[model samples]
Target chain A: MIKKVLIAEDHESVNISVEKTLEELGMTQTDYVYYCDDALARIQKGVQDDQSYDLLITDLSFIKDSRVQKISGGLELIPAVRQVQPDLRIIVFSVSCIPSTIEMLFGQSDIDGYVCKGRNDAKALKEAIETVAKNQRYFPRHLTQKIRQKNVHDFTEYDIKIITLLANGMRQKDIPAYLIEEGTKPAGLSSIEKRLNYIKETLEFTKNEQLIAFCKDMGII
Target chain B: MIKKVLIAEDHESVNISVEKTLEELGMTQTDYVYYCDDALARIQKGVQDDQSYDLLITDLSFIKDSRVQKISGGLELIPAVRQVQPDLRIIVFSVSCIPSTIEMLFGQSDIDGYVCKGRNDAKALKEAIETVAKNQRYFPRHLTQKIRQKNVHDFTEYDIKIITLLANGMRQKDIPAYLIEEGTKPAGLSSIEKRLNYIKETLEFTKNEQLIAFCKDMGII
Candidate 1:
């Protein structure tokens, strides 16, 4: 049901493909820009004219050019656009496959959707726009699975501190001593071992090393 | 000085930019194709016609379209092109920032150079082409640092095996026993402890956990 949409992508081919996809969805009133600054300008102008874009499709990494602009990338542009038009829905279309980067966009930046630029991405982009238009969140299936896997193994702050210390090369017996010196309560060797064992059991990790590696990969530590 | 070059990039804008860079370098006889099949065919035909391309600049991931082709990605195309023209200097022009993937291309695939597509990449790509033309390997400053960091700590097959076991949730104490059962030599607890200590010391890692995490990130285990 969304009529007005704006796309901010640096690559002309990708920008054209996105425009084509929007056309396929029967969206005739679409605006496209190759720079973040231009996109922001259009949004600001739209707001001033009392005609705002319903959604914003953007690529996170824009190829830097000779032009000097306040907004260098899409991450910065998102919050800037949000401030001008709080009702605008945003979807990040990027090639960044890093889980931590994607997690930050979702958790911290509060993006409505993320569609990785890859094979069949045009299809994925179409689905994302349609879903986000209905005021719903959308993430690719693989990313959803990754987010779910991360959520399934919820680690407490205390658990994270202990594992982080272990990853930093602290011996198991030395942890309690360090914890006590740092004024943490229940800093007993037995308690530390019990807590670690409980966490390992819950996560189905057989070794402390594996648990540490998992935490590091998930950016929990 | 290199006179003839061939670029294999699907995106029209990137292809144009790469051609422009070549033009800047005074290399006018540049051929470009949007498909890997066309690239390989061009190389084959070039060889047959007694005029081979001096350089092959390509991107790793090509966006798939309705047309089905055998040589879909750059990894496959590199080996194919190498078979037809062994002396053709190759440089991967891509947006991929994964160190491990780049490491594999350099270490295993034996590519001449890699120029990441990012800020000031046109300059980097020009440098890469020049360096590779002189039979020298070229990786960007950051990528070279990553490759050096990887090489600084050379892990033996035995070291990798032990770390893989540890990462798979096997305890250090249980590793010796498992090694003995698996018919691995010097499976004594003392030898295992000594090897672990040596690896940690060499890598400047304080903990066995850190060692495991490092190995995982580097794709060693």
Candidate 2:
């Protein structure tokens, strides 16, 4: 049972959110600190006091404060805390949706979960906590991609054109109309659908938006 | 004497925080809608019923829902609502700190205020509301930099290196130490300070972090 948790977010509103979510999950012994140095000190104090926290939820970037500290960002804080309390379940709460940065965190920092801060962040936080408590790693459900997918196809100019249109807010169904109007080949709806499906499989993506975001991450479009 | 207020935000926790802030400021008639369309509808309904809201606080990015909406984003909703009721005071509460986008919102959408969502957002919202009530425009104070500063300098390779180091989380004081270790010329703290201050002045940025962020936005680092 993950009862004691430490939240290392700077935003008061975000802290209120995480607190509310933790309360809903029946966990009340949660402590919060806004600074990375302060978070490290709290974790150290907790371990020394024999009241070690079970989980650590932190933001990647803490706004710069007046005081200078060696452990500046959450990236610095995570490894330092791991040295002090290796078993602490850690989840990053940040606005960064960059997959490469997130993948690096999971690999290097060994965080237990990650939840992007946004519209359904509270719901995502609840799910992340529940999932992490079950000894499984959690990633944002909507933004998750098959990063392990190495089945790369040499993307043609036409494929890039279609994906670029999709990225520019053109509806998936409306792509064929634009292509047809532009006098591009395979402008039929069925052809567009088949091509998109093939691209999705090549990238191992389950949704069009995920494919778009991946293309953005890889600078493909 | 701003009385009735409407909050358009998707996050439940953010709504609670906003509602709580409103309550603390002695406003109980504040209504919250999770969608941009719902917010516009409420405003329209209020006008017809002769009970128009005095202020509208909205997030720029609303989460996508099941039903498709004609007014997809806050940018679209603002102008549409402006046509219906030109006197309605509007405040944007968004995660975007981009100065150019905010400047455009003020110029095009005629929004009364802009508050960045972050560590001090709740406090910033309070200040923005108080300031806007006086018939003034509100921009996030900490992030404010003169966007009209047209003075351009051909930045040297050394300048980019310094700003990049700052952006990479090196404290200004520690910068000289790193530069000295690298055998870079003018590695003294005073020389670094003088150069940084000159850059800030050139960019019309009052803070080092602002200078770093501006360099990032311009792709100079």
Candidate 3:
């Protein structure tokens, strides 16, 4: 039941292709603007007329220009539109892979999906629109993996201590005593050993030194 | 065939639950490391032993030292492991809502997936693991919306000019002249009109003046 789509893309070919894709997908009421300002203007007009765009598909980078614009790029445009039209579904279809930019866009906007340009992700692009329109998140396989890898590094205080102590060659039998002295409840020796053992087993390590070496290499110690 | 899972988490209760989850999933070969150091060491050892883990799941916010390790967080550990084991399937699980940070993790590192710590996203997290195991991307629905909303303000030079001209009451016939004088390929009269028409149609504008008013209000002029 998707009716209107607003695309804010600067590249003609990308724009044309996306438009065609939408049409092919039975989204014939697609509209496009080459820049952020025009795109916003169009969306606002639609809102005023009570016919707001159902979704917004945009590119990350635009041809740079030095003039007073409401915003500078897709990064800036996302927040503005969200403020005015919080319910609008959005999809970022771009070629850039700048993580910082992508993160900023995600944090500030209410986008529904993200897709990379080029042939490899074409099938993913169509699927992104359909998924986002249906209120589901659509991130290409690798991007999601990247997000997970980043999350793993966010450790807790206890985790840090365990890693540091393990790196220092402290035996599981001795860890509880040291932790208890520091006002932490002493875990059973078997529990401590089991935890370390689990670490070894899961990471596929035969000994503790390998884990220690990795910690040191990563500067986790 | 779910294989071994390496958990680099610090919390006792959480770690236990994760272990239980693994057991429930019929994955008894689970390893739990409470610190980043231990996690890395174990992973390396496993790699050396030719028994590398099938999955490396870690918390993103682990503390190395309660006081001295305040600044060094989980994010610092990704690149280290990636260098040694580029093929490792790493997933980051955390409670951070920072879009830029999430984007950086997803975009820069060799991560496989990111899952938030909230109850609402727990199901998504489980799905994320399954997706990553299958080498697919998984962006949580809420997270994607925030990222998209953050980047809508970015605009380009050409967009500024067309918007300014439109604001000045330049007729559609005059737009091509302005564009050509600016050393830009002037879109045909119909083209210019069509672009504007699309804008108006998307925004639901009945007249050109409304679009102009919107631009001025957004500071696009």
> Of the candidates shown, which would achieve the greatest lDDT relative to the real structure?
1
- Tell me the tens digit of each residue's lDDT in model 1 across A1-221: 68899999876646656777898899979998878999999999999999999889998878766787889888799989988998888899986555666776788778899988765577788899899888898888876676666644556668878888888778888998899999986799999999988888887888888887777555465
Against the hidden true structure, what lDDT does model 3 obtain?
A: 0.66
lDDT of model number 2: 0.78
Q: What are the RMSDs of all candidates, in order?
A: 8.3, 16.5, 28.4
lDDT of each residue in B150-218, candidate 2, tens digit only: 355446668877876765546678888899899898898898889988976776656553454445434
Better of 1 and 2 by TM-score: 2
Model 1 residue pairs with clashes: none
Question: B40 in model 3: Cα distance from truth in Å?
Answer: 43
TM-score of chain B of 1: 0.67
Q: Rate the local accuracy (lDDT) of all candidates.
A: 0.81, 0.78, 0.66
Chain A TM-score relative to the true structure, per candidate: 0.67, 0.66, 0.64
What's the lDDT for residue B10 in model 2?
81
Tell me how many clashing residue pairs each candidate has. 0, 0, 64
- In model 2, the fraction of reference contacts reproduced equals 0.24
What shift in Å separates residue B24 of candidate 1 from its native position after superposition? 13
- Which wins on TM-score, candidate 2 or candidate 3? 2
Cα lDDT tens digits for candidate 2, A89-147: 99998766656567767988899999876667778889999999999999876556544
